[model samples]
Target: MLTREWATLPEFAAMALPGVPETRALQKWAISGNWSRPEWRNVYWRRRSGTCGAIEYSYQLLDRPAQLAWMQRHVVISVEDEIAAFGDDKRYADEWRMFHEASQTKQKKALEILQHLDRLHRLMEAGHTLEIAIYDVCREFGLKRTTVMNWRRRVKYVCRHHWLPFLLPGNKGATGPRAACDEQAWEFYRSDYLRAERPNHSDCYRRMVAAAEKNGWVVPSAKTMQRRINELPTAVIKMAREGRDRVKDMVPAQERDRTHLHALQAVNADGHKWDVFVKWPDGTVARPMMVAWQDLYSNMFLSWRVDRSENTDAIQLALGDLVEKWGIPQRAYLDNGRAFASKRMTGGAKTRFRFKVREGDAAGVMTILGIETIFVTPYSGQSKPIERGFRDFAQGLSKHPAFAGAYTGNNPMAKPENYGSSAVPLETFLAVISDGIKEHNSRLGRNTAVCGGVKSFRQVFEESLAQVQPRKPVAQQRHLWLRAAENLTTNKKDGSFKFLGNRYFGSFLNDHLGESIVVRFDPQDLHQDMHVYSMDGRYLGDAPIIEKTGFDTTAAAAEKKRAEKLLTKATKMRLDAEKALSPAELVALMPDLDEDGEDLVESKVVQQFRPRAVVAGSSALALDCDEEQELAREREEMAEVMQLRDYL
Candidate 1:
């Protein structure tokens, strides 16, 4: 398309004047009209190749109609049309590879041969004999006639078109010996060398040689075995030597799209134990586990709790804080850890595998609040987004200036020189963590999908929050996550139970005394009331802590008095209601047995009894005087033996 810079006399004549088909007639007309003048804006001339004389004219010198004709004749409408017009073939795939690998001189020679072939094809297309075409190409390219024929013969059988690759000089296949080792020897070497134990190549070669000597097989050299190992695919070698998990890790991980999620719509939770040492309130030094919940959409750290270790209580409280402050999330991506899978958090989930699933189990906080719980793969950090945030925290928070001596490296082997030299107080550690978390959320230009590398996480979260209505749990619903659940039985005597060293009692518990019920309470605040539920998940009532006092204290006396008053009031109410119906009135209220005027039903079977006779007698006692004296002496000996037995 208007690509040619210049056109010859015959080309210009055929394009500019369709009527003047003869080049000699067009030249005569141009001379008679004197069209070569500079003011005419036509017939601009350019020197011919390898000649001082002008032979071509610029296409711009033609009139509008002639230029249009030329453009229409040569215009390329599409890129594919242009490529197809060049007759480019796919065979160049191999040709270019061989050409690149060949020596510089060989590469130059291959290009020269390709140019000669182009000319030879053109000459042959013009009705010249093959020999004559080859001779002309050889004469023009300064090559021998035999050399040109030999290049053509080299590609004659295999490649009919795009035969530049086959025409390349030098060995086209692999070099060196073909059969270095037999199948049996190769198999033995592979088995010995490509093991999970990963033996060295030289050692494996020596072992293979020893085995070859005994088996009468030919073995290859150590270098040859090493080369073969290198030729094996990396994945295959890794699978054989490094194990399946290592090979699996080499594969790219799946990416998740969270563009549709909004703030508080979904969140992820995980526990990370900080490497920095802190002195706990109990006077013990240890690394603290921070259970954190992050908003999935904005990647913002919504809430967190620090404890001596990861536990159900810490996770529950952290989730509670998240719900209380930012509203309830629709879904939670959690770690497959015992704390995250606790019955208190995910009790009734069908996918929960940590505890035994049972019928009529109390629903967990997530189940009660209608939030979906998704457990990530166990021990897989990539499955949870919070792990990345925790990594960032580890880099900044753990290495803070306030924790200089207390900074313990991520692993034992990476510990700093001053590790264990000192420990920060728990209060100071918490304060620093609070400041760090604030700064992390408020930092500008968060390079996340939601932030678009322009806004902070807090800004992104708040913007989304403004556009969506997140579920907000009321005070009663908040207890579902804020409190831990336990199946406990109330005391049979007073309908009260001991929990966390405190006695909890409720008047409603009197009806459920000695019966198993679900009790949910805040572990951090034992003084607050606990929410009670039946085993079948029905809310019973709240049980307040029964505060203790000295027996002689006025408070104790007042409490006793209050209890007595309550009992008296309850008994009076019951008695008054009962008295409303007198004994006779109650009897009258009962149904009369003879109202139908039917005879009483009798027993069908008879019970038999045996008769007994009784004899009554009052006989007078009489004894002789001699007999009486002997009886008196026997009685005295009996009395002495009784006295000795009593003394012993």
Candidate 2:
């Protein structure tokens, strides 16, 4: 092909034209330079000489097809020869050998090399020699020629071995100067430094030095020791320095997935001591205890009670308030505290207080109400969602201006500026808590993390209540669920019942005297009326308070003395009710009795009518009626019998 027509040919279409030398000396130098072009290898008609003369080309003598064929064959041969003769330098040769050896073990590194092989291979396919290809790759990737060469060797090794190079494992950042210290020194450092109450860095360093010198080991500098301690895993540091209970503060709180729970489906109850000082009814300053039940799904405070102490009675009062307002909960999550886990709250178990119990001896409130009880792990506050609500409660309500000067800190180290300057009354404290809880429930943003959308606590709760039917206690049957009950016998004479040194009386109980019956009353309201129930759980009428014998300043002196005297009498009556029937007493109640207080002998006729059987062994005897004797007695009493139908 002609030089002018070379541009039209596919082979030379993408290449820049080669320039001619300006002088004969330059041309001669270029011809003798032995500079073979990778693209020129396809031009077989070109010729060169070792003289200061222009080279001649004769490719025009051949047709286009013949020229194209020569270009293809020679280009392929040149590329093959270049790759075969590459890596002749000693450094390149060593790298190539090492690359092959590493292919079996350094699979990860080899794979990384393969990632960049595409760009390098594309340049070589475009008629560039191996050296030019490596240089172009280095420029394209902004990598050094040596790095490019190493990568090329790795690629070739991977192609040959059909595998990649392995990667080095990651190392921990704690493998520094501290590792030089002995295990004994580490133990001393951990005990003295990484404890529930951690010591200061300088103190820990000084102690560590002393321990190291005694143990014949090198000690770490204060700065290095501090860094080492800081470098420890956050979880490890929290658990070691603050104990497992406080480790939750260091970790991110887990958002509970509560889509399955509905409002009133599950409620969590826990007691918290108000950090602020409050005055009790009897004029004493102390932190009042607050027990509250919160809905798990909506985070709404259902009910709460303020008391001087935490006990099962307080818990029941709070729970009962919720039942009265929102209906019964399906499940209750409680802490593993003594008050929450008491028999009165959780029911008696086969094992409690480290003792075996008989079946049916104890019945818990949850069991009676058919509510499931879920006790969180001991000391794990985060497990109960109410704890988070309580934190907000303390900061919002307990810190109100009304409680100014009375605000105490949540912990001993965080006392307020006006700590102990004043105190709030119990009633005022409760009022603040109640109002704060109402605001919290109605406030927006409680459902920010909820899936449906953002809403207030009350909105979510009301929506949930709309979807499912909640169990509500019947008004007439409230007595069964409102109080803890026990079975007691009524006084046979006046049908009076005594509990907690108080007497309860009912006219309907007269028929139930000497019989076991269930009595229900609130322990907190001993002076109030109580509901009476039959042994079979049938509700009787309410029993009114007959007298406030436990503690009553209104009673006169004579009345007080009489009330105290009834204690022994009530005990005697209770014991007598439990006494078993004697054989003589049973014989006295038989037929043919005399009105006078005297025992009569058995008549012959009466003996014939009454059939008797004697026992061979003991003093016991069995009684039966003889059919023949009974018929003879009826025949003799026929004349004395009157017709009841005619008299009517």
Candidate 3:
């Protein structure tokens, strides 16, 4: 190529056109000195101008092919051989790739070197190089001398900044994945650092590093590992992005093994509408929420809440009730309902949402409790069997044969002039909820006689509880069933039905018991005296109203009470189920009472008391249960018989 400085634009082209040096070709030192940037090689070509100096010039990319070819044909210094002049440096982002269009040795070799440097720039990213780096390039695309020089330069920076092949993963301008990854070793860490993400990937990585220190495992420098990671396939880059999203969705909860339920494996929880009909303190005929927690192994409800709204406040209180009662559970399982489910409930909700869940007021409350919360798929109610049980029990209370009474706007707080003097709205709600749960759970299931063969929800729960803890005392059982202080009891004494016969133990006893003091007993700790609360939050004067009887607990008198009670219940059922049955059908009935005049669910009593052997193991295929389906099948068979008779 000719020197360009001394030549005009046209002469410069002419000089570049023929490779003969100015002295050799023109018999004179023609062009002046070289293009300035030696640091920018390849593009600049130099030849000794004279004894004084060498003049360097460049072939503009557009017109270089023909000139290069002429040089090669004339054997004016092998066009391919000249690129080696720079040794090992090929600039990373140089625009020299235009040389690929070159038809001759110099251009072809120049293009080849530029491409090779690009590959090395990518591989050196992770800070380590594999022998395959060069071999693969050669086998795939045939390496050239220029490409070799580029590889050697890369080898020099092999242990350079960050991972390897490149400088730090994404240049020095930004912080890595997060501030926590500041250390070079941590930067190099990948999911390989841990096998599981339970205490997820990040947690596992943290532990593995600490473990390495304790166990003396040879550790690779993180900066180098980061480089290797950068060299991974584009597919892996895609996976990183996608995996991050997956982790974000999975926050508040990490995937876990299904079989992890144990005594405290996980606590199943959900909300239920309470059945007790009492005017809420707000005078709304409200169905208070029943939030319950059931221990997986025991099936025993460890804690329950009966409140108006199942908001965060209610939920937090429910959790508090449990923790304060039975202690913390390892995990809590619930559905995707707004009330019970929150990402922050598990894995530190903020961590689960990948910090989308900020520390708000409600979240702060739950965070302080430290219980891991998990949510099931939305709408798949069956996923939360415990919640379903609560539902069944609560629903059963509303339809119970004996329950009667329409709440007549019972808001004690209606007189809010005095929050204290006003009936605590929650107090009435609590009474209804507490009584309803107990009655529902204790009542024999109507279908259980055949369907479960005497196995009601309460029965199953009790059985499971027994199996989980073979010898749980009644007190402990009560603790699980009722709650904090409701487990204790006091005895009835001196002609009065006592609280476990202990006088003045649980609640303040009105002067005498048999005379009629509203008796209170702790369903939780029957071993101790129960604390009593009046119709309000009052600690005063809970003397039960005495039955005004005239020396006779007579059959006729009992019959009349039964008749009245039944009439009351039937009337309510008629009103509530107004959509279904007729008023006359409802009024014509009364609770079936035995000879002794005790309330009884006649249908339930008849079916449940049946011998289990009669039903044995029932199945849809066999029609063994009066299991509703059995009755339905019989009705179908009868209808089929009638259908055939129509022809006759």
Candidate 4:
């Protein structure tokens, strides 16, 4: 390989390269660029020791003179790096920057030619003749037919896909390349269809064997088909085959354009489960839950609620928050799972949702919201902008030297700082989350992207969210988490997984009907979203939620604390209700309830307990209300409630 070293960074990139700025990495230098650009982005340099004993330097930024200066002074003592550009400074000025300039000219010319070709292709759709097509190409772009032909030649002709009208009569089985192909139709070489069969057996093999008897040639025996199947790509080969089925999002981070901020323009949401050092009733500390919604339009958190359990109630309430604030969004893009699907979340008996049928009251919400709740295609994340929002959220915290937040995660890759537990309460995580948002909005650079990236989107988002206070942490976030967890659990139609609140459903016992079984959920998906897999780890649908979310550490802590608090409060209430009243009066206070009612009065007296649900909700997102308290107390007095753990 040849090597060239440039005296200046620009000179280096100015050397031949297809995509300018395809990448910029360097050592021994750092940049403090203009405020107009995002900070802390691609601005450092390093020297490397290449295998060929070459010493080289790298540039982390492009187009910024400020960064260039940094690269100048920082020198590495010893190293080898791939030589950028290869040749001595020949001092070209010979002034035409050669390769770099030449490549640009070529690209521009190619694009111009491509545009004309595209125009011709479009005209073809309108049934334009070849001459007319050529004329239109020239007309649209000031270019001639031969010039257009050259341009067309430059672009590999797109083999007419989908039905190509008539096959030039009898032009069956391979055409064009196969047009002249006769009974020699079976001849084959390396292609996606037959890159195998003769793998190492070299196509050089002079075989007269008829190629899998062209299309009409039927194969005999399953064994033959099996042999062909065996010839297909192995795992490694299959993986290497470029997937033609999916469109690649080659748009670099910078290409994302920003749009105007409309109310229902775009919504981004993410669930973050924070392991907080919450103050237990016993004065100990543990983790809790947090789920938030952010407006991509203005970067404002539409609403955020935390719950000990992180249940469906939180998700529903979060939507309620959005409903109260902005009515409804035109689109609600959610991760593909229990959180967004309504079958598990439907509140009204009439509400029904189907990923397939997409109907009923649950569908009504979509209609009302004027929204199509799209689930990100499986495995294709960069699909949903919300997930990007969360990433930006975490990055904002980690990149900020000022933030001191902490969090843990089940999937090492999924964990964000705010999702884990540190030595403090969940408050710190909330503060960190809020501050990160505020700081990002306050930023004047590219990090303020609409879709969230170091690009044009940031600028548009900042300009739009100008009035909306998208910055700042929410006040009393922990309180909300506790409140929301109360009623999150419920049963879904399919009963695939548990709903958010930890609600129980019996369908899972489909086989175990009379037997008790355990259910689990993701604390992140409020709205009682859960995955129902068997103990053996087979996935069941996400329905029949146990309480809204799951019994993750956060929910457990919330439940435990709430249980103790409710018990304390209930004991006081029970004693007061019983005071000045006889045992019969106290018994009257209790319901005509159950037969083992006597224990209820005594238990309430000893422990001061309220039903688990009420307390749990209070611990989460503040579900405590006059009615809840009243009912919990009433149920407590007359109940021999065996000190049951679930509801009051």
How well does each candidate superpose onto the true structure, as a TM-score?
0.66, 0.54, 0.26, 0.32
Please report the TM-score between candidate 3 and the true structure.
0.26
Cα deviation in Å at residue 150, candidate 1? 14
lDDT of each: 0.78, 0.65, 0.45, 0.43
How far is 395's C-alpha from truth in model 4 (Å)? Answer: 2.8
> What lDDT does model 3 reach?
0.45
| The 10-residue segment with the lowest total lDDT in model 4 | 162-171
All candidates: CA RMSD in angstroms? 12.9, 16.5, 29.5, 30.4
Worst 10 residues of 1 by lDDT: 75-84
- Kindly provide the TM-score of model 2 when superposed on the true structure, using C-alpha atoms: 0.54
For residue 287, model 3's alpha carbon misses the true position, in angstroms, by 3.1
Model 1, residue pairs in steric clash: none
Q: 356-453 in candidate 2: lDDT tens per residue?
A: 34343445556556678877776677789888888887777878989999999889899977789999998898888888889988887554554245
Q: Per-residue alpha-carbon lDDT of model 4 for 1-648, expressed as tens digits?
A: 112222244444455332333125322222234312344322332233454533333333333232223223332211012112323443322211222233444534433333344445644654556786686446544677785564444333333221111111121222233112223323342242344333432222223123545444332343333333344434434433434332243334334443466434667555765433454446555555556766656555567776665556667667667656545555565665555454333312232243444222121223323355655565455554555656665545543433334434435686665653344444555576566666654554354444455434335544554545432213322122122221222323322223332344444433433322223333445545333333222334444334443544566656756956876697788778868778898888896866765564434445566765445445556566887899989888767355544343
The reply for model 4, stretches above 4 Å from the true place, is 1-261, 273-289, 298-300, 308-310, 325-327, 344-372, 398-422, 447-648
What would the per-residue lDDT of candidate 1 be over residues 1-648, giving only the tens digit for each residue? 234547776877766553444689767866776656666443366457765665676654444334434544553333233234437556445444555556877756665565566556545654568987776566545789887776666656544344555556763322234446878888888888789999988888888889889999976677777867776667888989899988989889988888888999889999999989999999999999999999989989999999999998888889889888888899898877888998888888877878778876778878777789988888788888999999999988889999999999998799999989999999999999999999999999988778889999999999999999888887667667767898788898878988878899888887887988888887768799989988756788898888887745766766766987897799799889878877899899998888579877999999899886644452324456789999999999999789745644
Query: After superposing candidate 3, which stretches have Cα over 4 Å from the reference?
Result: 1-260, 274-277, 341-347, 350-355, 358-370, 400-429, 439-648
lDDT of 1 at 551: 49
Worst lDDT run of 10 residues, candidate 2, spans 166-175
Which 10-residue window of candidate 3 scores lowest in summed lDDT?
A: 160-169
Pairs that collide in candidate 2 are 105-166, 106-165, 106-166, 107-164, 107-165, 107-166, 108-165, 347-364
On TM-score, the stronger of 2 and 4 is: 2
TM-score of 1: 0.66
Model 1 RMSD vs true structure = 12.9
